[model samples]
Target: GRGFYSPSDATKWVAYESEPAQLLTIGLGVGLFAGGLGVMLGAPGVFLAFGITAASLVFLQFGVAVPVSHHIALPAAIAAAASGSVIWGGLVGVACAFVGEFMARTFLCHGDTHIDPPAAAITVMTTVVNAAAAFGFFALAKLPA
Candidate 1:
């Protein structure tokens, strides 16, 4: 049975998928930085602020389920709710922002070539976050199957 319409099993489907917050959080950080891409600019810091705000809101909205917070707009309105994953995901987003800016300054700005800092940050942080999750560092983020 798909159990989609059943109230008791409504959330069962999430078990088959990877956590949703990870990609979108990364997206928020990367997209924002990419939009405001600049050398030593305030984009990363803004990204950081978003991370804290979004995740903390998740901590507040225990009804929506933190993993459900894939959009940056949610935090502004109802937000992710709770679930430990939200905070960790927020940290990941913030980390991506910090790293993206750092990469931009260290590798892109001083160099003559155009290496996308957001792209690099996304790639590296994706791997790092997943690796940490696998190692039980952020295991709470995973939905139970």
Candidate 2:
């Protein structure tokens, strides 16, 4: 029920939809703050922070009446949910944590100013995942009934 979209109303899942141009832009805005935190926190601290965020998202999805498909900050978790497996969502969430930290250390950490690792990571992962979804890569993953 709280999933991306029910089979009957598939239009609700607009996580990567480029038409409105809101979710991606919102991610960038949120990323500015998240990246600042990453720069201030350093190392696994930022990674752990994102992990908790992702976990909270999962909780919100399962525990509450929320849909995370439009959340670009946690693209991996979104992808996992699109794949129709909450377990996979948890695993992907952790892996995505590593990517956020890695992106921070590689791109943002070395820079003199805050480049925003979470933003960069989200952009990269979201593009790839959305592209895959566009190509029907996730078409095989049955939506729950």
Candidate 3:
């Protein structure tokens, strides 16, 4: 009599568990570091930066299932995060200036757009530049450092 026999072995499953935990820890640590740097340089809020990086990494993990799609998706997430941060920061700066100008004019009658626009523009430029530079530095730096 020939019957299908299944081997009951739990040893392989136990070994597999440890490696994934270590890998996940390493990935999270790296993501946190990268995201923290982005926030420090005014790229974006810490949560946004970490979310973007984590999403990108998660997309990339499916490289085998859809190789080309994963390749395109990861970079797209990074770029979108960087550009969005720059634009959002810039808009916030401009809005703040407008509010400040309105308050000043109402209270002190001395504020004007003649100076506010330029100041806002500079703020936007500075925020964008700093964000880009921080991103570049991280890309070129040694990993896990």
Q: Which candidate comes out best when scored by TM-score?
A: 2
Please give the lDDT score at residue 88 for candidate 1: 40
lDDT score of residue 104 within candidate 2: 48
TM per candidate comes to: 0.40, 0.43, 0.22
How many clashes does each candidate structure show, in the order listed?
A: 2, 0, 0
Q: Which regions of candidate 1 fall more than 4 Å away from where they truly are?
A: 1-84, 140-145
RMSD of each: 19.3, 18.6, 22.7
- The whole-model C-alpha lDDT of candidate 3 against the native structure comes to 0.34
Instruction: Show model 2 residue runs off by greater than 4 Å.
Output: 1-73, 140-145
TM-score ranking of the models:
2, 1, 3
Instruction: Give the per-residue lDDT of model 1 (tens digit) for 1-145.
Output: 4332231223322222123454445445533332232112333533454465446546546654443222232221111112123344344444554565555556655466887655575567656644664576544555221
**Which regions of candidate 3 fall more than 4 Å away from where they truly are?**
1-28, 31-35, 38-43, 57-61, 64-145
User: How would the candidate models be sorted by lDDT, starting from the highest?
Assistant: 2, 1, 3
Worst 10 residues of 3 by lDDT: 66-75
Cα displacement (Å) at residue 39, model 3: 5.4
TM-score comparison, 1 vs 3, better candidate? 1
| lDDT leader | 2
lDDT accuracy of residue 145 in candidate 1: 15
